[model samples]
Target chain A: MDYDYIDRLLERYWKCETSLKEESELRTFFSKSDMPKRFLPYKDLFVYQQIQKTVGLGSDFDVRVLSKIEPPVVKAKRLTMFVRIKPFLRAAAAVALIVLCGNITERSYFADDKLDYNYKDYKDTFHDPEVAYKKVSSALMMLSEEIKKSKSQHFPDSLYQNDLDSVCTK
Target chain B: MHEFSFQDDILPLKDKLFRLALRITMDRAEAEDVVEEAMVRVWEKRESYSNYDSVEAFCLVVTKNLALDMSQKKDAQNLSLDESMAESEMDESDPYHQLANNEKLKLIHRLINELPERQRLVMQLRDIEGESYKKIALVMNITEAQVKIDIFRARQKVKQRFLEIDGYGL
Candidate 1:
């Protein structure tokens, strides 16, 4: 191609007059092994473009990314299955705790259990160990309820964290 | 599908994206980061590939967007200079000519960086990407005519610099 024609196209190129096809044609024309001196300024751009087109991610990168995902959590994010449902599970657990703890002051279930432990006279006459066993169980239940309510009502806010912490702290 | 293999699709685009990112960022690491980010993004969004006009155009848009975003996020991230890529490229001219092209490319990158954001985008998409006007418009969220005008201004500014550097007095 004539330098003047190419130079004209390039002039149009920088001015946005060349169409995409025209622009590529200009690049292809200038990308030749030889070019007029006036056109030499543009050779790097096209040659660099041709080089760029052949570059690829090295296999090591693929290996690195695959290994990163092998720990299950990455897979969990990719699958979106567990992530999508995780919030609902946490919300359910939080609401359950709220309901259980919020009503702690009433001691509704403990009141009935406490009523049954008043059989101390019968226990003394019959010398039954079963009545003593029932009393111990009721007292343990009352203590656990108070502990749960205090923890839930205070700092253990996130339901998921609370569940994990409870299991871990033991 | 084999059509989207990293070697075929991504490697082929590396040199182009490297230069594109280099031109926009004027830094090799930033360019590399943009290219890698683009690759990972393409990998992640591969399932949605069928929806785009062409994967090449889609990838270019992604690359350009990431380069733009990275430039905006950190001034330091984009300040480094690019090394001479002249060793890998073919040139029939004297080594000085190659040197000139490299310098011009660096200068072009700087000039393009200072363009209005839209002009910079349109210039990169239309010129560097060799994208069709319609695709450039789509990527830029503008009309084809708007893409054309912005591209025109961008091209003109670069040509102005090119002419000045080459002493083309016109």
Candidate 2:
């Protein structure tokens, strides 16, 4: 298939005379699987021509050189969910914390220890002052005992909730 | 201004720049330095890079200039001939490993390097980089015909060398 022409092209190619298209044709001609023995000698050259397509500096070259360039600029995405919702998440957490602390503090506020219980004041406040005080004191003593027991025994927090419910039911 | 990714417009050219540097300086370390300097020059002066054709070719031209300057300076140092030749061999790494098992192409690649510097440059720019004739002519600052002649001569050399090694298939 135009072997003479290819041979001539090969001759031109060696002397730096052939055009790129001609050289490529020569390569393609030799690239076929059925390249004749007469053409086999030229086969590798064509194959190598194609292979030169892969040649260049090695792979790590970019890594080596670009190491000195500025570190990549990270542009913040205006629409990313995490970024858009970040403020809300923080605010929610802060509100939750404040609410939790306030709830705890409100419970502690009612537990103030400085009660000036004058006998007359106690009498005025109760239908049966002695009986009512005795009942209230006994209930408080029971609650205090349960709290101490739970603290020492490491009871589930549900026990505290239950205690609050039962005692506050009165 | 050239509008493109660092990868698209710049990073991808590393191997080509490396090859150009390696060809001129023939030492990996020195070629690497040249490529870095070239990249810096490109990046720093990129504002002047009008969004015209062939940004890659522009970078390559800059790299070639840098490598050529370095090589010329070293040549001026008047090193011993033996030392200069040895340095040239240092960075001339094999471009064949990238090829498939085609001996013809390997032979041609070697022959292409054996070509005169002008011819080799022509082939590298036109064939290896797939640059357009106009763009390559611009890069080399040569007229289109000179580029064509040089490339033609380079291909002819490769073909001749391949045939000679093949012994005309015995």
Candidate 3:
């Protein structure tokens, strides 16, 4: 078998001068048996390329990929299920939220009952106006005296401590 | 416009995408991830595929970009450099013929992997995948002339380096 044409084409192929069709012819020629020894160096490379084309994804790869990207027909069924219940689910959630808010408002209003009881006690005390006035005046005077006494005892110490703190911080 | 069927069209591309991804990243797992990602992307962008000239070319471009992006993001060294050497051990039964063939195959694989990025892709698309120059140009987003030049340079480099290795017994 004369490989002169193939050798010429192979040269052209190495130089990237061959067209696609010519390269295909070379590939076909190299793939067959009885390749001459002179071309042995280039034989394995082309054969390896032919084998490399067989390098592929596994048999299960399609199932794996399709499962991920394109949802199965069952997904459409699941979507239908979701579509049926979505409005009801929304309504239920809204109702639950409203109920929760109502309960919170009621609890807040009831929380002030202790303050109401304290107000009742004050109302009872102020029923006797003149006595209440004397009592309030006495209380006010006692608080004023207490404040004045504390100020005299601690104001100097606090002022000195503040100055120390400021100096230390700086 | 042709319809994009997962079973008929997209799923069949898994092998080609896997090979391209594997060629670039040189890690089987990473290549698998890249192909899966590419598959999902093609499915997601199925609507816009009508605008493209070729779906196969579009998918190849996507896979190449994704593989390159993955390598870039992880700062992955070209794992192909070391790994292809380890993978070329064929069956030991046919020692004389198989051993020489396997060594040459491994050397070829490593040499191809060592090619520059553009040339490697061009050679892969042209030689391994049996893609036309026009399709390769579309996938690589280069002119057909550039594709020709890249393939030429890549093939010559492989041939020269291969002969040198044989001569030096490396």
Find the candidate with the highest DockQ and give its number. Answer: 3
List, residue by residue over A1-170, the lDDT tens digit for candidate 2: 87789778877666556665776687678768885567776566556545556546665867766666668889976688898899999999999999999989988998777678676665355687789889999999999999998786686779868988999998
Write down the C-alpha DockQ for each prediction.
0.16, 0.26, 0.36
Per-residue C-alpha lDDT of model 1 across residues A8-43, encoded as one tens digit per residue: 887777666776687788778867888777666667
**Cα RMSD (Å) between model 1 and the true structure?**
22.9
Give TM-scores for every candidate, taking all chains together and pairing residue i with residue i.
0.49, 0.56, 0.65
TM-score of 3: 0.65
Q: For model 2, what is the error of residue A110's alpha carbon versus the real structure, in angstroms, after optimal superposition? A: 54
Best by lDDT: 3
* Ten contiguous residues with the weakest lDDT in model 1 chain A: A68-77
lDDT of 1 by residue, B1-170 (tens): 55556656655666566656655654555677788778778877877877567777677778878987887676565533332333213332533124436555545545666687778767665665567888877666679889888877776777667667656632
Residue range A136-170, candidate 3, lDDT tens digits: 99999999999998876776888878888999999
**Candidate ranking (lDDT, best to worst):** 3, 2, 1
List pairs with backbone clashes in candidate 3: none
Clashes of each: 9, 22, 0
- Model 2 interface RMSD, one decimal: 3.6
Which regions in candidate 3 have their CA more than 4 angstroms from the true location? A72-170, B76-101
Error of 3 at B151 (Å): 0.7
Model 2 has fnat of 0.57
Q: What's the candidate order when arranged by decreasing DockQ?
A: 3, 2, 1
